[model samples]
Target: MAGTAPGAITVALVDDYDVVVVGVATMLEPYRDRVVVAELDTNEPVKDVVDIALYDSFAQPESDHHEVKTLIDNPHARRVVMYTANFHPDLVAMAQDLGVDGYLSKALNARELVEALESVHAGERVISTPPSKTFANSGDWPGRSEGLTHRESEILALITQGKSNAEVVALTYLKPNTVKSYIRGLYRKIDVESRTQAVLWGVRHGFLPDHRRIDHWRGGP
Candidate 1:
């Protein structure tokens, strides 16, 4: 691997939603001098060599999944960082055991986020302080325009992927009743009376994961 430009750590922002990664890229814009965002990938592999591959867990699997391992195994990514709101003790321990360089909280401000990346790049393990409540919704997701919260949209996305409520509970670590509540709320927002209808609505909308990459050097996609 090649060294990054002096005084700037090359980074790749990875997520399943364009708006999610784009939002993170926009947040890091001011610190371009310290952190050069080389790529914004949506459900795609990182194509460029970078100091850090910041995997944003936005409506995607948590850090314990194979996705994190994929990033870690990529030769182009010098280090892998999990940028997620899920800070359960088991999840944190699992990420650390999986050899992630950093486990960051989405509640971090831009400056804090940059500093954590820098620390990881400098050969130190880092983890941010977990938020008291759920992390605030910062970026976009499917059904946001239809009054669905991020969590609800996440549930609907899983449903659109053909995951049953039990599977959703397993994947999301949400209580069974909580999952049901989200499904009910999601159905109400989309005006669907049945799961099949909700799935159809999600399919018509943008619940599916995207497959594209945005290169910052040549300008974003």
Candidate 2:
């Protein structure tokens, strides 16, 4: 991360919500000399064009990524830097697969954020999640959905081990609705759209526990 530092990396701030837009804009104000920031409208394409588009997640866990996808799909933003809290490795992987130039954290201070921007602008693929954090319930769960809550991770393990929602409920002694909620949360956290994907992701991330012995699991998702 070494550069002579330009006047500023021209950046267009894009976030669906107003408070998020304002909050990020204010955060960048202190770095005014390092980065020139301009806001983008929620509906219209970017009016104040820039060198890169900094899209904020505004602490949406891994939720509401469709908005980020929309930003990536449109051609208005030259380089799409995900200024987000969705730092799960799996989620970050999906973002990279979606062709996000840089994956950053909303929790970062102004200096770290600015450095990330500069690195990203210099043609780097920056996905900042701790690659080692997995679904295993180690004591040091860092943040939301990145490693998942203990129960959610355990449920994800069972789901990957081929447990149905009902079976998971029984295994965890949680109600069916609770199991379903955890399932949905797991899916959203890992950014998987379906059972098969979630299973594969679990396997890929070593998230399996032990499989429950059932004659046969009922019903398919």
Candidate 3:
């Protein structure tokens, strides 16, 4: 569950296996009064009041894409737990990037799954592996250059919105080559390697306005 309020949370389980479904239902029997398993299939829309959701990684790619889209689109779908038989490192990283609350191996017993749910409900990230240690010791880099020109800042803002080079050029009315030059300058000013990383840093340091506010970029006549 995502929220701390016991009465506020509704859980959904989306999986293809009946055995797995039975195991999860058995584990959640204690909280059956509070937790409602909507269904075993991914055909239905995830309810807004649902604070937590679980998905079987073995689900078809189309189902997985839709599930991720649903969770990302729904602001209320804050915590998601993905259970899979395959614990491949790349798959785990992909799950983390999608902002899942927990990634547990399906081979684990119901007790472990229950514990993961409990921890995730408590607002803790319940993933099985530890987060990267490099970030644990890394200090914030003094990378921002106050001397960035206005146009450079504008380019950075567009990049943060995840606009591609061609899109940025169209948005700014700049030539493609000019856009690439601006991006190079942005990377140097921000001390980043790629446009995506530069954009992330810009957003993190408040150099870029919230991407949702892009309409503000078009000035009134």
Q: Sort every candidate by lDDT, greatest first.
A: 1, 2, 3
Error of 2 at 55 (Å): 1.7
Clashing pairs in 2: none
lDDT of each: 0.78, 0.61, 0.55
- Flag the better candidate by lDDT, 1 or 3: 1
Instruction: State every prediction's TM-score relative to the real structure.
Output: 0.84, 0.52, 0.46
Q: Best candidate, lDDT-wise?
A: 1
Clashes of each: 0, 0, 0
Between prediction 1 and prediction 3, the one with superior TM-score is: 1
Tell me the tens digit of each residue's lDDT in model 1 across 106-208.
7787888889999999999998888666544555567777888878888898899898998888777778999999999888889999999998998899887
Query: For residues 1-221, could you state the per-residue lDDT of candidate 2 as single tens digits?
Result: 12314667877765433434555667777787787775433334344446777765432223435655666666655688876543555567777878889888655667777888988888997766543333232121112347576567657766777878877755455678888888898888889999999889977775542211110111111
Residue 3, candidate 3: alpha-carbon lDDT: 39
> 210, model 2: CA deviation in Å?
46
lDDT of 1: 0.78
RMSD per candidate (Å) reads: 4.7, 14.9, 17.9
Better of 2 and 3 by lDDT: 2
